[model samples]
Target chain A: MRASVHRAVEELLSEQPAEEVTLPLIATRAGVHPTTVYRRWGSLADLLSEVASSRFSGDIVVPDTGDVREDLERWATAVATDLADPDTLAIMRAALGAGPDGGCACTADRHAQLEAILERERSRGGRTPSVEEASDGLLGPLYYRALFTQLPVTAEWVRGLVRKLLS
Target chain B: MRASVHRAVEELLSEQPAEEVTLPLIATRAGVHPTTVYRRWGSLADLLSEVASSRFSGDIVVPDTGDVREDLERWATAVATDLADPDTLAIMRAALGAGPDGGCACTADRHAQLEAILERERSRGGRTPSVEEASDGLLGPLYYRALFTQLPVTAEWVRGLVRKLLS
Candidate 1:
């Protein structure tokens, strides 16, 4: 039943903007009772966060080639690519609209991934920035460019940003 | 009449989220015909962009004590303060929702302000980055932290970011 609702949301999101995806619409599309949805998800923000978590949560697989720069580049490039997806971007925007303390599962998972990578660096005796610092320095630029500017978040651009942060 | 409309938008925005501030609501609040608003602004995106531009657009007055760091710190701190406002953040989110090429006048003006600052740095033989580069590097982190994280964009934080960029 949850899977059906999630699939319905994904379909609706693909067809329309996130703001237009109402609970009634999801219930109708998924063939589930509206009450069931309300009982389970409680709110649109919670429902979307659940969807985002299911889609985006996971352990980040970083290459252990021993070079922090290369590993960071690979991880950042992957994240940039994921964020560049129209669907992912839509979900993220929805999460952001829910406010900072709104428990955005995707962003939480991303934070964990960043912490893991930073921990690896710290263990290697490399200069490891705080998760907040690393997030603002690296992921912030990618999101800012993706969401605000007309510039493409290209691999080359990601590479340049990594170099700037490292230097 | 324009002032009335702007005032209505500001009033509505203060009371409700940007998405809920429809043209009819603005028309009702401003005591104007809905058609007049449609004719003038065409869309909610345009209306919000106009509101944001009127509120945020201007020549950024960075101090010119021949110290780029101090000037940048002042400028960034001011911007952070502006963005921390709920109304400004709402309008900005609306503009972002309208997409990158949606011609948000406020964002364009902010970009222009950043360009002007960078041009001054270039004249001073400082390593002036491209406007896009500088924006993603400096202003990006500020906006990201302000909008996403719980961290306050303090003057100290702005100063540290400026020093990092300059270094």
Candidate 2:
């Protein structure tokens, strides 16, 4: 049922809207009763939010090989591969779409989740960045480019950044 | 008429089916004849493709400050701003949404346009990095994260990346 709901929303986002996404649309698409959809997830936004989160909201997969550059390169390579996946990237694009005219709890939550993982990395070594500003020093450009540009991330870029951070 | 059709397609993307992105929709939305739309662009796809390109398409805004770090930061900042814009990014998202469907000239053209700009940047310094790889050693991560992460890009990250490139 969870996967069905996720697939339905994913399809809905990709296609031009013939209908506004709602509980009824999801319930119909999932071939489940409206009550079942509602019982499992109370609202349309709620269902969609959780569905989006669970898709990429997994373990951090941090690697600490005692070399910051190597660790960072490995982390970035994995991230680049994941983002290059059309399905995953498309879902992320939708979540970040239009910047929440009202407010999207899901978007906010996902962001918080990403930040938390980055924070864990920031604090892992004794030389942790001291402020959100310092953390931004490490993460800001990468996040901005991933969300926006068509640039294919290369391996050297990752290694260079890790080297810079260590230096 | 071209602008009318483009606007009509834009509306369809936001709230209705692209099939509805027709002459009648343009007529009703812009108070013009359906023929006006066809006359200007020959078809809805032509109108959409043109408009989508014009909307999202821009050269990479590469800089030539002699100092590679400053130039790179300027370039990176422009990209961040472009990706953060909902209109341009939304058009690309919509095109990608059509998936591996027929006649997706818009997607391919935009991709090529971006790549050409990147290629131009590569040849500028005469010390060419791999054309097979993303440029500037690790700038790919900057672009990728900027586009996909949907986070507020910080000045510090920009500065750090600039420093790395110039160093």
- Runs of candidate 2 with Cα error greater than 4 angstroms are A1-4, A10-25, A33-49, A64-71, A97-125, A128-167, B8-50, B58-74, B81-159
Q: Whole-model Cα lDDT per candidate? A: 0.73, 0.51
Candidate 1 residues B1-167, lDDT tens each? 89999889888877764445678999999999999999988876677667767877774565675766677777787888888887777666655444333324556777877777778888988886688777877877987776566677777778878877777
What's each prediction's TM-score?
0.86, 0.58
Candidate 1 chain A: worst-modelled 10 consecutive residues by lDDT: A95-104
- DockQ of each candidate, alpha-carbon based: 0.36, 0.12
Task: Show where candidate 1 strays beyond 4 Å.
Answer: A17-19, A38-42, A98-106, B17-19, B38-42, B59-62, B98-106
Largest TM-score belongs to which candidate? 1
Candidate achieving the largest DockQ: 1
**Residue A50 CA error for candidate 2 (Å)?**
3.6
Model 2 chain B weakest 10-residue run by lDDT: B97-106
TM-score of 1: 0.86
Per residue, candidate 2 scores C-alpha lDDT tens digits across A8-50 of 8777656533124556777788788889988987654455446
